[model samples]
Structures are given as C-alpha cells and as structure tokens.
Target: MTSARRWASVAAMLFALLLAATVIPDGQVFACTPTRVWDGDGPIWCREGMHVRLAGIAAREMDGSCRPGQPCPEASALAARDALVNLLGGAQGRTSTGHILVDGPTMRCLSTGNARGNRTGAWCAAPSFGDLSCAMIRTGTVLRWDRYAHGRCRSR
Candidate 1:
C-alpha cells in the first residue's frame, strides 16, 4: 500500500482501539445518536450532523440489489433494513428515499474516512449492541465487507 494509505489505516486502528477501550474521556469520542437508517449497512443519519456508513459491512440496497463487487448476504433488503432499525431504536417514519427515521441508541465511532457520496466511513458501537457492524453481521442481514473493513470487524 502507499505510505499515506498505510498511515491512514494505522490511524484508524488506533482510533478504533481508543474507542473500543473507552479509555478516552466520554466527550472525546465522536459520539452519534442515529436519527435514520438507509439500509442494513447504513448511511445512518446521526443527530450530530454526521452521515455515517457502518464500516466493514454491506447489505442489500433498499431495492434488494447488491453492488457487483460487494458481499451480498442472503437476507432481503427490507429484512436487513429492519434489522438495522431494530438495532437502532426502531423507525418513526420513512423519508422520500424510503430511509427510515429513527430514534436509535447513541453510538461512539472511529471515523475511517469518507464513504460513497457524503457519508463518513466509520466503525460504530452502540451501547446495547456493542459493535454495530458485528451485530449486523451476526443477524445474517449483512455481509462482512473485507475490502473496507481494514480488520475492524475481526477485531470486534
């Protein structure tokens, strides 16, 4: 890997370790309370104004399509979406894009970088669920996306 990418990966790992250990002061972590779920693997809208895509995983698109190179779990799109909503606190409504509005439990995340569109790629952990990506994978709703995982999912 390029030196810059290597350093970035190292940085993300350190940050993730810090977050998982909870060694830093509470407010020091980038905490987000989810306000919406776009799918099983997220673009989880956070009340904190961060649009977070759960790093290290992929689920079906809202219309049940999986990207050509992504890991596509056997679960249907709605099933995966609902699983995420349940992980969060459940949906309050739906947006025009069919994303679910939620009042989910707060999460602390380590930002890896930018994801597709304007979303931030992050490995997030909710209080009740521990690691969100791992939880999603356990539910059989999402697949472990190794390309972007950077070993985060395995660590959890």
Candidate 2:
C-alpha cells in the first residue's frame, strides 16, 4: 500500500473505533441466514447466488479497501459492512434467529424512478435491518452503484 493509503487506513480505523465506542455497542446480533448468498462488495449478492447491479446498492470489497476520490477510508468501508451486519442482526437476516420478517425487498429509494421491478435485482430485509442498500448508503461502506446500475450493467 502506498504511504498515503496506509496513513488513510490508520486514520480511518481510529475514526471507526471512535464511532464504535459511541454508535456501535457490543450487544449487536449477527446471525444472518440468507436463503442464497452474494459476495461482499460493489453490488448486492442475493442468496440465490446471483449478482445484481442494483442502483444505490453496494458493499465494500471484503479486502476493506478504499475507492478513488471517495472520502470514506478503507477501515470505514469494513466498518460500514460491520455496521450493516449489526443492523441485520446477522450477515444476512435474522429470520432463523427471529429478528427480520424476510418477506419483501430491502428498503430502496431513488430520487427519479421506481425500482423497475425484477430487472434491478433482489435483496432481503428484516424490520431491524431495513434495506441493505440503504444501510450501505447510511454507513458509507459500499460504492454508489447508481452510475453502474442505472446504465447498462445487465442483471446477472
């Protein structure tokens, strides 16, 4: 890693630690049980084992790296994912553990359009987690996929 990025990472970690002290307590549950599964970054992965380029939906690469020109640091990315896990009460949803309803799409909103139905992709939601995409946005852990999802990335 470049010295700049290394420093950035260290700084980000410190910030995340601070945030954890204030925002993330130690009692969060993490029993996500996705019916299917996706990877951990740049897009939403459904339990069905499909990758969806959902607009405004994203997760940081599990490597915990940083994005070019993005202010969020590398540690922040990982921290965001961790935060989402806490929100979801697990890695997926806490359906088996009894924290999520698991009956509908995750909380999604766009300033200019409807979800456009099955073309966008799929996500799971529980009451506590709300929507994963929104959670990523809230935590700044994932990339802003609107540029990719809204354009030509076909659902795969």
The residue-by-residue lDDT of candidate 2 on 1-156, one tens digit each, is 999999999999997655323211122222223332233332233333222333444554455554564333344544654555455444545434333222223433222222332222433345655655555555655555655344423334
Model 1 C-alpha lDDT per residue in residues 19-105, reported as the tens digit of each score:
433322212358888988888888888877677888889999887888998898899989998999998878899989777999988
Off by over 4 Å in 2: 1-54, 66-75, 91-126, 148-156
What is the Cα root-mean-square deviation between model 1 and the actual structure? 12.0
Rate residue 91 of model 2 by lDDT.
53
Regions of candidate 1 where Cα sits further than 4 Å from its true position: 1-29
